[model samples]
Target: MKLANKRPFVTTLFLRPILLLLTLIGNYTGICKKLNVAAAELVEAKAVCATRLRLRLRQAQATATCIVTLIVLIFAGAGTAVSVQAITPNQAIDGLQQLAAQAEENGSIRVLVQLDLPFRAEGELETDAAVQAQQANIDGLQNMVLEQMADTNTAVIATFKYIPYLALELDAAALETLAALPAVVAIEEDIPVPPALSSSIPVIGADAAWSVGYTGAGQTVAILDTGVDTNHAAFTTGGNRIVAQGCYSTTNASYSATTVCPGGVEEATGAGTGVDCTAVVGPTNSKAQSDCGHGTHVASIAAGDDGGSIVGVAPDANIIAIQIFSLFNSTTYCGGFSNCVLTFTSDQILGLEHVYELRNSYNIASVNMSLGGGQYFATCDSDSRKAAIDNLRAVGIATVIASGNDGYRDSIGAPSCISSAISVGATDDVDNVASFSNIAPFIDLVAPGVSIFAAVPGGAGTKQGTSMATPHVAGAWALFKQAVPTASVDEALAAFQAGAVLVDDNRSGGVETDLARLNINNAINSYVTGLSVAVTASEDYLLPDDLVEFTVQITNNTGSVASQVVLTAPIPQPLSLDAALLSGDAAVVDGQIVWTTGQTLNPGQSLTRTVSFVVKN
Candidate 1:
């Protein structure tokens, strides 16, 4: 459960038998090829492998089964048939029954224990005093849990303020005792969240947002990744944009490399805490194991402003960099790689917890986490990180994450799979879904991620993935926050979706998805702010070829002048525009009338333009 820590019952009892069966089949094939044996002696074998995948019910203690069938193999060794035996694990993956099974198999387990008490969103508590009182209640519950498990070999691995849960390492007796308690709601394995893996400003219309003065000035975007190169030119071109830094890398002896934080500590904060992780992290065969610039690349894509050469989406937005990954060595944990980058869910949670704490101090609009592991089709609202995400959302902070780079047509990765989190997939410059992008109905949006040029640890570099795509949205959110300071996370997201272009992904053999490709310029223009527009017509009903006069009135409600005003009225097939009646400077383009007002609209000012159209069948 804790980074390759669990060795279940089936592995101990039935592993050898399955291995022997596979060995015979493999050896027989090689021998026949080398010895020129009779082809008939090695005949085809079709197998409906009876692999029992078990899952235990939470409170009912019942068993649910699934099967993995392996078919079509060339069997028969020594002119005799060779059988394949599959040994399936007792895959107890939920609640108390899982805890019991894990205990019986491994003597102890690591888990995220969810308590019965519901945690309130930040918005639910209207006042700071109310929030403090709620914190007191949560702290009391945590204290009670510690007291209950004091007698057993139980250790609290991590405690969270935003989420009502605890990461604990406990023996089977302790787990059972805790489950029996009335406060305990359910439990799940504390799974390892590994690193899943940018680009252009103009493709997403960031330039338009910038021209209109929404350059994300005074806003802070949090980047939780491997770590950033704070001294890189990408962060310090216009100004010293890196405002804050923190590190929360996990190091488990079984699966993780040495601690990546400064001084080799598990967690640290302040200057130099979030620098690049330059140690060798990949396998020995890897040519660039020492290159750990994922966070640096991700940060620059979100808000890095390096003169003009490699600017990110929010060129002027400040950054709060935090390190949240560790080097994992175990092949089981590293997806068969001898060494690779992975992060513990506990560390990521803590990193988010730290971000929540800094919310009051910084004008934080969003947190960018371009990291994930494992794919899911539906919302993973039950993930331990969801509590933190929900809490952040309640206070207007959005958590934007990568949908993953697994190329799944119908699923996305976890953390991003959480409903409250804004999951993003990758798209190329031409607006097609990237081949490596994980797609699903749950994906929130898509952004340009192919061949993205951004900041690496040393200098500007090129890379691409859903990881690159995510920062575009994060930076766009920062711009939204700057443009409309009072906008909530939901409002900003809705605005983005409102102007997003739905791009269809029809790759591979899976259900196709039409996901929203980010349109920052349109989203900003369409979002309600200081300006409001209204339309009226001369006639409510009209017959074919009837003349109808329509008018659009623009009003500025803000105290200051609204500059760079532009408007477009889409023309339907049934409507015919009378060019003679068109208002000043208004021209039709691609089935729409476009108008660009060079002047600014002052406070309480209104502008109206009238045009005539004919209704056609």
Candidate 2:
């Protein structure tokens, strides 16, 4: 029989009412038929009716499932008319189309169109052939739209294979047609992401870490921003620190290791030239040089060399500068923040893809993104950006991002709002949250971001924003990675969180914000070195003026060596340490046995010392 409606009637709402009505009708019929019978027979008939009604209800529920299955089968048979929610355009795409329509200008707008692709589990390895096949599918779909646009005389700007999307310039009139394509799942306006805009490192205890010799020597931090200054003294480690650079902005030329752009000069000169050499190449405007000096400042905060005055959080870590923003022109204003800096999500995505590609060459431990725009709530709305971040993190790179400078509650922007990224807010030198820094539940850590001094393109300068705070955490990650090369992003994050200093006061509005401030020394001491000490007395009981011996043992349980280890044992009450009885570099000072000259403890190594104390009644 033909169904009354074409729509599926499998929902419980439609079936429950019908089932209840049937039960009611059955009960009524049973009562009417039983009224003529004896009292015992009528009671039995009522009981039997209840059992039949229960069975009918269960059968109705099962029929609903079958109806749902039938609906699916019917839709499958209908071919292209089947409605799939996964391929439908989301609200962000609709919003962008409306925005495009409202624009008075008649120029083509750049948009990112995302496609629904097969799901890949975290860390799942796909063979080169498989990857190329998947990319071919995406490219084929993209080419279809490009061909359609070619007929209408529109240009395709760029295609992305890393995240199943394409960046293209499309006219307002063509947006509706393009969005209606079956492969297109989302289309968002490519907005400009401005630089968030560092700090006193000592406030975060980087000095202590440095003093202990964990200077992030073997680690590399990738900076994705406007660019870095290769000539800057901060990055100049005799051509050893600045390892690689590339320009991913659409305005600039494609990837080049030896040349920054088409005719740009190589940063390094000499025998180890061109192939596999440690030199960065990009346009002067987007390379190690900066007109706004934002990227250079951020680079200095993360891994700049130590000058006499200013030192970076990870002084010895190498830098891989990826310029995602081209030189800003007059027309490109980043939401009125500044006229000189602008970037797009497509550029950022390209930068992330490049980072993943160069992961093996650079062995990058942490990535610092001190730039963001467009406030996004709890989760990242852009699938391409989120997927890129996840892929980088899955490969062991710690992605640190700034929680925007909007100063609004829960206004952390996209990429930063992404759950996997280490979202960092800004605090003043005194551990108070910065007024301009965004506050949200996702903020993982806060660092000194007010009037922070670091290496600018011209010279050392000071700037402020959550941007400054982000590199501190990135630099800390470098240090952590240096200590534990095998640690994952989550492991490093947990270490930082476990070692962070809780700041219950000094926030804005005098309200108690429960965020932990960065404490690099605590991170090193607690997580990196894994140093522990235990003390035990030779005898538990002692009489008046009795002699007692105490032993102290310190162990290093990590994979790295622990240096500058010192033990301080306070003389218990009613006890006094004898200077003459001290042994193994131990001395009595002010009723305490102090190991002034610290010893080095190798991995899985322990050191013990003995001292004698006199008990006084």
Candidate 3:
């Protein structure tokens, strides 16, 4: 400072300049540190942003895949739903129409609906196709469509869930409702006898006896007709005769034309069947009793035991009776033309449902339907009658029906014409075709149906009709089942058909040609081959009663047969025991019993017994 007074002025200026330079250096270092910290923060933020973007892209891609899968599943489900709806409704209705038309052309007014579908449209179009075609377009459950039909001038009637009742005793409200339909040509409560019986007697050839061998004893045959005479000597006890019994009464006796068995006992009613109210357990008829004894006669021919002079195809076959109407009313000919003409399709459907139950509940093998509407078709449908046939066949149950009493050449009746059923025609003892039997291409085979003697409710009597003939085939089928313990339904049918001989020319023309011939043993073999398991029943006992009873000891040889196997034996008529009680054990598990009954030994066991039974009075 002192030097500045003389020569220090320059030194002081230089020191001030150095202090200024140091201050500038300190400010620049602070700025550099701040810049470095800001750049590091920017780099971290950029890395986080890139990671977030990648996560969002992955989420979007996953969402898109899920959406695509859901769409595909939804489309597939919609397509299946549409397909089912289409088949159950529109398609089913169309199919029914086609079936109905075919029936009408074949002279049948009845149609069947076997599936779970409303049948209102069928009743509406009873007479006019155009009206039905138009009405059928309306939804089956549409109330507006129903109202429109009420106001229409067309003669189309519609009925649903109806049961066949005799003309005089059907529900008035139901009948009235059906009658009021605009398209209703007529509303009939009377359900005719199934195509089981023919208006005319059946004529079968002598070969029928030989065919009897095929029917096995112990096979059960169900008769969905009038009540049978279980007490008849001609019927086998525990044999091929009356295995079970049932009856139904759906009509009043005063107005019904049906006749009851000779006993004059009205079939029990109130349950829609002709059954004995007094008897709690027995084979009951689903219909009413008949006064004409038509059911009795038909049943006798179908499964009567092989008596000295009277023998049925499957005498050992048991029968299950199901009466549709009362045959005991003198005022009504329930078994005659009136009962046949007044029959409706609805009644038959219920009868078939009962049959299904019987097959399942009782293990019934065959069903004999001697009743049906006079209709036929090349194809099948769900119309009322067809419904029953289809349902019966679907369950592996065999149905035998009479062609019809109608003498129309080239025409067959409903149920009879159904391909799944065995349509039988009446033949004479000489194997001649009956004139009244409906001659048609659909006819499967001919059997003895004319002037056949059978058991009536009261006593034995002779009757003629294809109804009698239908039972013959049924009994034979039962025997076939017995012969071949392990036979399948289709195989049995084939073998039965194979044994049948065709009659090309009418009996009067004297042209006899064997179309097909079936033997009892041969049919049995064929059936065994068609089954999934082998049968091992090997006990044989000749049981002679009004019904033929055959006892056999069996073991599951191949372990393929069902645990509850059925045993069948074929017996012949004119059966008698010549020796004293001969009881011996054939094997530890099997035994033979030969007993001499009260009757003289005129009839011998040596006779080739197909189904043997004693004729009961």
Candidate 4:
């Protein structure tokens, strides 16, 4: 046979070094016997080797094989020595496997089942008759069964079984125990923080101007909605202010044919979470993000300050971005279904927890929840939402909730109807309640929520919604908190109510029903004018049928100071104060005093002495 043309031995030259390394490894490992066997095969493959050379190669291979065999023996002995010292099994490995198989055949048990038991009894029990007697006396005791199983000196068997399809049986008791487990880091109630709004007119008159006074500066307000563009001017305060509270994006990981995440909503520059609907360019872009820009727009309107257009109700507020729902489509569709509403309960719950954690950890005082669920079959009493609201209240946090946009009457959805929140209804620029804003007894007040101009994400234009109504209130609450450092939650709520302009219908009724309803301009023009009044005790103890003596002192603090104050006390039975004893120029001005006692007790003055009194006990 003719030999194929051969290349130069350059390749073998490179292989020579590798061969040497393998030889060294062989020597160390004592596998030189296998190394020699390979060498013999290599010699046979050489086409030009002479018979003498082949014989020499074979002799060398044989010697190498002997060395390798000795090395193999040495390594085997070492491995055997290590195994013998590490694990001394009572039964051979195969024998144990056979024993397990036999047991499985007899008992219909699985290998996994055997290992699941927490403990196993190897031999006979130790006698303990007294303990068995006591255990048998317990209630619900099956005497015969206990008698048979209670032998202290007997072998016992325990087992674990796998139920079909069920991973484990976690009973109600187990769940309750799990809730109290140390691994359960937290267990809190869900809360509702709805939105607030202002009257459409930019000004609240003079008295009502700072009536809801707030700067919202240095405070963070998280808007858990579609993702926001951090670079927006409305949010960044025209390159001047920026909220330090961190931001996070958690859009859906899974995608559907109708809905795509991180796309859809558009800004003024026309960029948004949506893509071009016309272009079928793969999954890159197809929908518009502007259709449902309610969240971003409301967020900006509540706290935006791009130097112009329309200043937000609270210009210095911070923004927290959360995308629980996609902004890619106006009417969110899913899985080829139109108007497919995917309830984002888990996401909403997480957002609530995140806000709660933020408040507890960082002292975020105010939060606004602009979302609402449709009125379902559940009643307010049965709803579990109170847990969240209560949790928020327990931590001294205030929430603003938007009364739903549903025009339907008497049907306010959860969290808004939740007793602990400030449920806001919508009012138009004309001061008329928005036709779309849902009204209910739970609604704390109404604000400008109709056709409102607010910020959108991605440097976008403004949009409108009752959703915009909430942030306005949150910003105002932040301001109220800032103004009255000593304000309690109840006091703060009172201040809010006392400052709201009384809404009215065209017929002059405080509450309007139709197109004619408007707000009375100065109805809510009161401030936190310092409070002052004097009290007198009529003879510490009252004896039967004796006349009492009493006197009064009063001071003025409504910007000016003058004498003449009036005090009214609601006398409960068994405890009546002499109303006549309420001295000073008793003039009542909207639940307040008109002037000071001596006729001119200036702004900072107080009655120097206490009034005296004697009562008939």
Best model number under lDDT: 1
lDDT of 4 by residue, 1-617 (tens): 11122223434444544565565445534532333534334333221122223333433454455444444444464347432222222221223344334434433111110110111111111323322222222111222222333432211111111100001112223223322222122222212122222234344332233333445665656665544555667766556333332222223222221232333321111133322222221232433333335555766655667766746666765665554442222223332322222323333444454566556344355667777755622235323344445545555566677777766444555557777776766766666666767665446766767666666544555445567666667666555555444455556666566545555433222243322121212222123344354557567656645454444544445455433332333232354434345443443333222333444456766664433222323
> Of 3 and 4, which scores higher on lDDT?
3
Off by over 4 Å in 3: 1-215, 236-243, 252-292, 306-308, 326-343, 373-382, 507-522, 525-617
| Per-residue lDDT of 563 in model 2 | 72
Per-residue error (Å), model 1, residue 535: 3.2
Give the candidate number with the greatest TM-score: 1
Per-residue lDDT, model 2, residue 448, is 83
lDDT of 2 by residue, 1-617 (tens): 34546544445545665767677677757665856766554554454444334434544655555556556766575445655443233343657546567432645667787764553413454554445445455555566557666655345656766566787766766776666555566777766566886347778888878877788898899988767767778877545588877765545221111222223432222222112212322245442324537778888889887466557899899988877664344333422322355567777877787778878887688889998876765767454577778778888997899988888666677678888788998889887788888877667888888998888765788888988899999998888787777888887787777667666435444344557789877666655437666778878788876777767777888877777754444456766655664556777765556664276779898888776756656
Mind giving the per-residue lDDT tens digits that candidate 3 earns over 333-417? Answer: 3443322323334444555556665664554567887876555645333234554455456556677777788765666776677
For candidate 3, the lDDT comes to 0.46
Ranking of predictions according to lDDT: 1, 2, 3, 4
Question: On TM-score, who's better, 2 or 4?
Answer: 2
Q: Tell me which of candidates 2 and 4 scores higher on lDDT.
A: 2
List TM-score per model, in order.
0.77, 0.67, 0.49, 0.47
RMSD of each: 17.9, 15.9, 27.8, 26.4
Looking at model 2, report the run of 10 residues with the lowest lDDT sum.
268-277
Model 1 per-residue lDDT tens digits across residues 153-183: 8877788876778888777788777776545
